[model samples]
Target: MGTVRPNVLIILVDDMGYSDIGCYGGEIGTPNLDSLAAGGVRLTNFYNTARCSPSRASLLTGLHPHQTGVAELVNNDGPGGYPGSLSLRCATLAESFRAAGYHTHLTGKWHLSNEREQPADTWPTRRGFDRFWGTISGAGSYFQPTTLHDGETPVPLSDLGPDFYYTDEIGTRAAAAIREATTPFFGYVAFTAPHWPLHAKDSDLAETRGLFDEGWDVLRTRRRQRQLEAGICSDDATLDHRDPAVPAWEDEPEQKWQLERMEAYAAQVRAMDRAVGTILAALEETGQRENTIVVFLSDNGGCAEELRSDPEGADQFRRHHLIIPPTAPDGTPMKVGNSPGISPGTADTYTSYGQAWANLSNTPFRRYKRWVHEGGIATPLIVSWPAGGLTGDVIHAPHQLTDIAPTLLEATGVPALAERDGEPVPALPGASMLGLLRGGEPVEHDLFWEHIGNAAIRSGDWKLVREYEGPWELYDLSADRSESNDLSAQHPDRVQDLADRWQRWADAVGVIPYGDVLAARATMPTQPA
Candidate 1:
């Protein structure tokens, strides 16, 4: 008889940065995640797809986002790559594990399907998970989210009590799934905390009340120092300059409101950490800790979108057709943006930390989410498996989000199938990290990323990247991981080589031309949900 497989628990958070958790250099309280890092392995150079839907798609299937039919967000825009849904040609990690007799359960965001009306075919339950609970959209009100689902059925916010919190609910559902499992389980806890609409509990808010008074400039410098001390980055890695667009923190007039916004953001992060502790405790209580593989990572870097009502650009920013007005549970008006009067952390308010703070959250990395920069793509990856012999160590090898599915399969002894449902699926593009986890030599492979028109390709230590409609930039990531230095002019031949490699990969994966997608998106009435 074969030995029983180890349980797999993947905890994914939305819109968090490379260094928000304690283990990754942030001051936020994340003892549970820190403990995981202390006992397991931390991948310093891990990467993601730089956006929500694409990152989720890559992580779920061991294929690039374009190959998985989600090149962009959940909007059927250009062609085969941007189908706005998980393609039939792919098999999700949950599906593969469930077929191997592992009980698969998913709790939290499910943004894979574009047709929410007919979610039965693409929802978690139909996609190999035995059970499912969470939102179907990418972002929404934490208090009263739209399109909340429980195994293909719509779960109204009214069904939940006044004290209900989305992050807590995800953790609770994940714990319940872990406890009820009769067989080795594959549990996915996707928390939407610290994303946007910055609504956190009063207690959580109180804990971080004075935390951000020092402002983003100081916070950024402090985090960079901490990151260096923690060995999260190389000793010689220089901190990227503060974004030229963001004003100096000292010159900011709305200090009080700005501080409060950061406090709310930190509160959201802390609350998410607390939820992780709850799930970890449940793992211990259920006696699944020793043989369970717990993997925790963020979907993307900190978001910088200002989803608020701006009076200066009333025609543009305040357009009801463009922006959906956020509302509280009782239908009370919830104002969003950098408005001074409207303090965040309440259900009656919706706001983001803004670009300055997001820059701080990313700490030493350039740009924010959506761009093909280190800040947009880098993520802290924590993998803990006591039975797998993974110990406290930092692996600096560059690994993409797509590598996660194959890693889990290998760890749990589940075989990757060449075909599923009688269709020949594309071969897994990601290599398993099992060898690295066992303290073996790091694996070498080319890494690729594209969202909208922004694109990048990493071959060995050299990275060639370009923004939408922008010129190509090259950097030796081994020395300049922050991408501060553009070495394109110095290495024209290398630039052409990497660019050629990216073009071939893009074409092979059926990635629609960026210009075509952008033109199509311009004609569309709706903005990303």
Candidate 2:
């Protein structure tokens, strides 16, 4: 790196798919993200933990989510499996970098903590971030998100002006932080965009007005071909069939409604990319563009959480989801559903892109978020550090989110803290990919993942995976990146070996069976997670 201690910037988006950005084969206008990918190294086969909080826990701490006590959402599951709050036993990236003389700052989402009404130690400020501001919960409306905090203090809704938008605010604040940092800084921008309650600016919506009018059936084929042409996927890699539950575009009755949902989703992505552009411009204007180590990725795969017409009162809706606001910022009653009559892309409207659009988001893949399948876990990972000589290259390395923290620490010459809060921390199971970022060949390794009941283990080129309560299926991912063919019957022994390995890991990481975990949670008193 050019500077003695390079600045660090990690940009994380919520529930984005593998090929949603222009450089990755999607038709969306993501010029900023595409430019970032062109100026960095793209990981062709990077994976996440297949859920939000689990993936965030892994990415920040460099440990499996089970090790950090966040195997699932920040729910009070009562410990049959894991705790909802992040364990202080493992030091976060901010803590490590701060200990090494960096001014650590966090902007946007902070779902690691389960504390809703009462103050909790797991909040971002107490986690070693010098400055922190964002939501403590998972998902909500972009117009008026609940749980807005500024370093442990809740931000009032009145302060967010009538025209405020969450995605825009997240990017704008992050850029301001970067420009104000007087020392080498470690900034984390966690954008909750393109997640749910799809809301976008009028201009952004205009850009994608008729983009998905043809619907998912035709778009999947076009996207897959683009993926192959761009070398994001292998030439022989075939697009998986559309999700079984989704009706064909020709067979569907709500064609106009479906098209509108996708347009809003596309607009959300474009808005996120525009935010990314501002962050990048901040790096450039501050003269830290080359030396700054910038990384961009989504926390998980595309979300399929469909929002339907809700009959609950506004107060009842707020009672259920801690992140959801009861009304719009202007005190307008929000329409919380994907009702065909309620056109989205406005402050008073709340809706998701739904399953059919999610299928297009995860084009060429079978399952959606929360599954251990390729569509659920696969994500685009971009690492750029011009001063470190890692630019404009592709690494076909099958890595996971756990590798991120270690890689950043290594590049910045910082050590993962050996101990925290007067207790010893465990060693990070993830190895640094800093070497690979700097033109080194990829070294094969085994990777494992579990969420809810879904499980997967990738060993070398062979992957053994299954849905919750489903049979194990094996695939040679080198030839079938789409995971269309299952080879379990032909190689039962390999399946057995991988399964045994996965079991051993689960036991080591405190993974309880999905049923057992749910049974435990059911017995506990319910609270906002």
Candidate 3:
């Protein structure tokens, strides 16, 4: 039930937006997360690496994704930093804790390895985790996921049982892991909820019905106002315009289907929140609540990649990614993508809450996932450490995902790993933010980011970012968290300085220009299919 050392629980969700939880100004019901935030520290300006695998890689290793061989998703894009598998050259949080005698467990979403066909060292079990439960692929059906695994072994669909739901199972497994721990534990609950394939339970969906019928326009503004009232964003921060590609809600043709998609999305988040409650209950039941440090954050901003709107949704899913399952566990045809007339939130149909809803999830931020804009990188970080003796508060200082590893290691009294097998592990780009979390004045330093070709560097309050092949833009994040006003034209000198700094950091971390990385992928030898 308890141990001498502190317990650590990190719950990382996928493709969730910056303000999609109630504590962060979202309308979605997340009482569990809200309770944690109400009694913990909620950060106003936190960031992820702008994509899934890369963000996970950085959070695990305390290094940039490029240095950890996860520059992009789970495929080798090119030489420099494009090896899409998590390189063993780095030290993972689990590895660090396991070496220090902590028992580690993972339940849900392990997309770090490129080896989906077979187990490899890149997998969590081989990388110092004591137990693992989750999928090895990026995204798939929630009813019947692809590359499902229990520890190092593959899980057959038949064995998943009739009442199986990935989110529920993940939460149950995580609670059990925590409750049964004999030693100080490190449990990573990486739920694939609120990501693409908007599948939800019927009961959960019923609760979300009519919740999003008002459409994205109204919801987006309401979320922003709540954010300001809650002190989740700076007072000066203002909502940016809606995404140019999205039409006014009233003008959209498929209103019914749009609401259904969001209903599914909200249901997924609500279920995930329930799981968080379960995890917390296990800690309390075991008397570990005061000693456990629980941190929750999303991997990236809400996704904008609209799924197909045609009848052949499954075909589109197949073409989009071979890894996505083609059929359900019962051998019935599984419909994928968000097509008209097909209600989402069912096991037979997989869909997405597209750009409009995604924009609402991200609230006032600009841009969507895969870009280096605020909407793509910003995340709401809620940290709860009752042992630290806080009633509840908010931390307005900015921080990035990479800071998590070092902070946990420091809080748990584990030394940072310097090398792996005498080869020096790549120096981490992040520092411990534990002091800031525990009521110390925040320190400022340059923060850098790059994914695909989009790149950025944040120095003090100023930030410089650019899309692949696009001109550089600058913003003063202290005043403009939404990134509405472009300061690049007026601050040419600052732009050049930040650009130079970004380039140096990129080269140091093995980042190649996006164009070059893709070009190399094109010429690489075909795999033996």
Candidate 4:
């Protein structure tokens, strides 16, 4: 007479491009993910907030990052972990599920805050997760990661063994969590693959050695064409060119290093996919396969962060910006250049593939992560729910990360609790996608995003986006998914109207002023009026 409540699994991959998966039209071999797509709904227009911590914060809290006080990456110094930490005011998705009688578990990158070293109440244990086994840092040596935690305890990952890969380790733990979970579980398995410090097993790395020899241009063009064929974008959408930082492949001094860099990245993704397969197998073994609702997505678009070499160097860059080489008058480094031969796949390097490669990574999309453009913020969302609950149809509605929490709550019949410890938390800000999932009318709503004063507002088919240093750009996303045609000059009134709406959202949420919010917090205590 009633629908069966299913277990929930939210798998978020780090720095994965929208077109990287095989289903999304990339060279990457991902059979496990492809199977999920075939059996479920492939969402083409879902978007993230365009960064790691912000997307994660909004996804968990159902509110924008500014409202949760994690507008950027949380650091130890910032209040409520402004740059990279979670705030106390926010109630996480895990909390909601736990309150609803689900056993909550989390593994992989816990970039929320490094409260593990601080106090018991500030750690993941206090953040609503009943069981936690993961790292507290953002990106680090995959071999012996720092801040690797078992609940609140700082434990060496070596305990897991030497040959253990971080991606596989996380996946194995996630599978075990499911098998051992006594009640319906909420498992948030975040894999930090394809991030920085690209390290893959020798076998995994060897498989992709000759893969990128085709070079960035060829790979990017091929991927873009595949995306077009898949109806992921408007046919007329032009492929966005590479970033200025990325040097042309022909100009690269060492093609071998470039090829190896990408090879390692691909291997990392492959390992993650394999791990997903393991978890899926566990779901079936536990008899929760068909009824379980599994949603897989990337945290943001392809990441283009320039990783540093070595924990010391990365720490130096993080603390004092000392690792960045000094530049001459012409903006070229006097001594140290952004050169290869730092030996990628080692523990000492922190280099991104640069914008040229990132351009290829995002394929037909306009920009990479951090911008509000299609390439940067857009991501592939695959939902797998059997038992005939969700229609196996592709829905192209523009969904934001905030909608994830509400969708989960509605699907699992979990209600958002108003109070935690007698204090009222923020209400859910996202609408449930249950209607769309059940093949009902298309859900329509305006989505907003603001990070470091770069703002965007998408209302229906029309989207208005503005970066801190650029002019306002308007696009009818229904017509121009590539964002090649800027209608800012053509439609002045509509631009103003969207701009006003963006400001209204910024004011409604607590979007910080452009620049370092931590710096503002530092000066507030002592500065005289």
Candidate 5:
């Protein structure tokens, strides 16, 4: 065997946007992440699945979500393609790494399986993680989360103390795992920070208390300007007009409360960043910093979903049961939503930053999460492998979440398996990005995305995309990264060809018909509100 492989750390944040990190042109303080970017390569055109579970499935299995049986969120429905859980036909990166003699550890949000049944076979431990510490579902109150688990068993809420913040616990546990591992390790630090419920520590929230008081309109312009100056976007890139559904900043009622909402979101991100710093520091203390490949990216773009004032209604919308009448440490009732007089950033609150702030989070992009637009799928992909000799470079090659597993496998010199447990595994649809990181010729491939009825296809600099039941829109992404101009009518043949290609790929991947998935969801038994 060759020399021992380098350690691998994959940091995935929930519901973060393309421009939310300091290195990616946002004003958020992310010194550790920015330092990684400065010392490594940043991919300007990397993409995610535009939703949480789907992105996680694709990233882990090295296959499209539909191919891994997670075409939709984590609730098995519809056909085999929409099983809503990681399938046996594909192997996870952790599984592969463990077979190659590396210790595997996963901490934080593991939404790859259905949480309602709590099936042990589908949990992270059975899926090949040696150690697992996280919530099975997607989003929840950070303070007192539901379905928290360790390895194969559920962790009791009584075991957690007042200082048990989800993001901090994730970092702490992952760092501990790294320290204890005797062999090269593959650690996944999946943080559910800044997703929803808008919770944060008072000290962290205080850091951004009056930061967003100017509102999203000013912040959006400022982020776009910074993006241009930092070469994150081209000088000729045009910022897309704000979504019509979002009211102008000046026209919004409850201005102070809205500002408070954004400040709370910023604080959540800052807290996650601090946790990242802690893990990186741990790696350095262990003398593993130089050999470890540290990657940081968000699962998807910023979320625009609003938190309902009714706890039951919110729980139903979130597709999970939440602890009703959530309370802070002081035992005060949590008030949820954008209603005036109720502030966020406390355990006594459940709220989201809303669409206007999500628009600002995505900066110059066109739409929010759940759509197939740039705003929905674009993510900041920072890869830091100091021993690999990568330094302060920007790679504009378009890559998908499916590429992550293959890239890591290649970087660690692990061979991909053709089968597992006598069952043939699906081949990875993405190519390794090592060459691109090392300043080699760009890897070119057509990429396709489908969520619900929304879909997009990118071939070279041209992209063809559409909303649910909407007309196809085309853009030359090289010049219009914001997707402001529709060139579909100007290039009807290209549109037809790209759409045809996407349809073929979708069919091959066993993607359930968009309408079928919707019908199945509609027919499911509704939870009582």
Candidate 6:
């Protein structure tokens, strides 16, 4: 038989730890994911942009977050709408696939655009995807969401009744969509599970209730060791401790709530894995499993944001003034906060395990999600194609989220289209990895990352990373993947050169555009080496 066009399945999990899955050597029960990794290549050094929306933007557009106008999160304004909304200048993965004669569908979180004043046309359907069944807002109750959408129309969670959990529902919808899709299809299944609100069914939570009660210290050590054994990190490298914000486990008194919260989070992951198994089964049943190129990854590192505890803009308002109506009525007074003592499963309690727990989640990586350190941006990437296209092995080559779009285009023999808006889209910044998947060396590209004041530049084996409030820290990733050594003093000249190159690239691609965030970024030292 003649070779057929490969279908694409991009499975995205939210806030997943790098070492949490069986493929990465953690104890998490992920049979489906492990099977995929065993059949295909397990990417050992895949890097995300360190956050959700930005990473998604890069993954879909083959460009940096700044180039996509979502350098931070979505910030909407007047009638013209949010600049952070999916810009017309860039072509999304679905847009390209649809142009290439493939059906496009998405079922999960849609954090890209949610501006009230913006016209309905700015949403996913008009943007590119043929169909979208998911939530429009950033994060919400997994059981009852505020802005759930089934394609272009608004849908209700209650429509599924009390039995509807968003994670399971997303998987079911995706499986149905996959089975019903005509011809070559591109399915982007983004799950927002294991992210927040620590709400899981009693039966689901029961699976991991006492799993985390041993505390963060033990968990952190265990995960780090496992990662080293899996070759995700170097065994000789030192694992960095938690950030200053995280309290030592020795100081923690109320351990029960902490344990329960993590149990709920783990349950979410397990449930998502079950969903993945369901979708994979659907693909097998459809007899398209062999020809399908399945790529699974998380957007960023484990999120440490305590929605109610942190004093930020929208977070502050939501934490202090949240009002859950008695029955979705007008002006029903309510307050939501992530208090330490309150049990997580209750409706009133809004909580996050905080930085200490986030440290445990990231294992050996230096920082959490927002920063550019290994832990903050590194993610587990598993790609499976069983028609003798992809082999089972571990690839140590560095990969970026931007590579996803171009990789898909290259694999399916699709061309990159011209931009719609007058603003010309930049050239493909990512190289094709088809050769690497076929057991050849993947082309190397200088990887760069920046979010607000945090910045990192990677060229070959050396990486220079700087946190918002921290000093410039350098590491030769070949020797120190955990970023435990500081080579800044020894390699000052190289640091200066790399920083300059990164700045020039950033300036060319609108990394620090004019905005409130830019105003703050402007105040930082013009050049730091």
Best by lDDT: 2
Model 6: residues >4 Å from true position, as ranges? 77-82, 116-119, 242-250, 309-316, 319-335, 346-348, 421-424, 513-529
Q: Write the per-residue lDDT of candidate 4 for residues 1-529, one digit (tens) a residue.
A: 1455678899998888888898888898899999998899888889998888778788778888887767766544344225345777778888988988899999888777634355445467788899999876676556666667888777744475657678888989999999999898998998888776566788888778888897887888788788778776667666666556677778878898788778878888899999999999999999988888899998888876665545564454544221222232234432221347555664434456655666777877767788887777888999998864788877888898989888988788898878777789888777788889889887788899876667799989898988876789999887788777889899999999998988888888877666656466665432110
**Residue pairs in steric clash, candidate 2?**
none
Predicted candidate 6: what Cα RMSD to the true structure? Answer: 4.5
Candidate 5 residue-wise lDDT at 305: 88
Task: Give one digit per residue, the lDDT tens place, for model 5 in 231-319.
Answer: 88888878886788988889988898888888899999998998998899889999899899998999889999887766686555444
TM-score of each: 0.96, 0.97, 0.96, 0.91, 0.96, 0.91
| CA lDDT, every model vs. true structure | 0.84, 0.86, 0.85, 0.77, 0.85, 0.76
lDDT (Cα, tens digit) per residue for candidate 2, span 104-183: 89998889887865668888888989998888888877877888888878888888887788999899999999999999
Residues forming the 10-long window of minimal summed lDDT in candidate 5:
317-326
Model 1, range 121-171, lDDT digits (tens) per residue? 667788889998887777766777777888888886679898988888888
| Every candidate's CA RMSD | 2.2, 1.5, 2.1, 5.4, 2.1, 4.5
Sliding window of 10 residues with minimal summed lDDT for model 2: 312-321
Candidate 5's TM-score reads 0.96
Better of 1 and 5 by lDDT: 5
Rank order by lDDT, top first? 2, 3, 5, 1, 4, 6
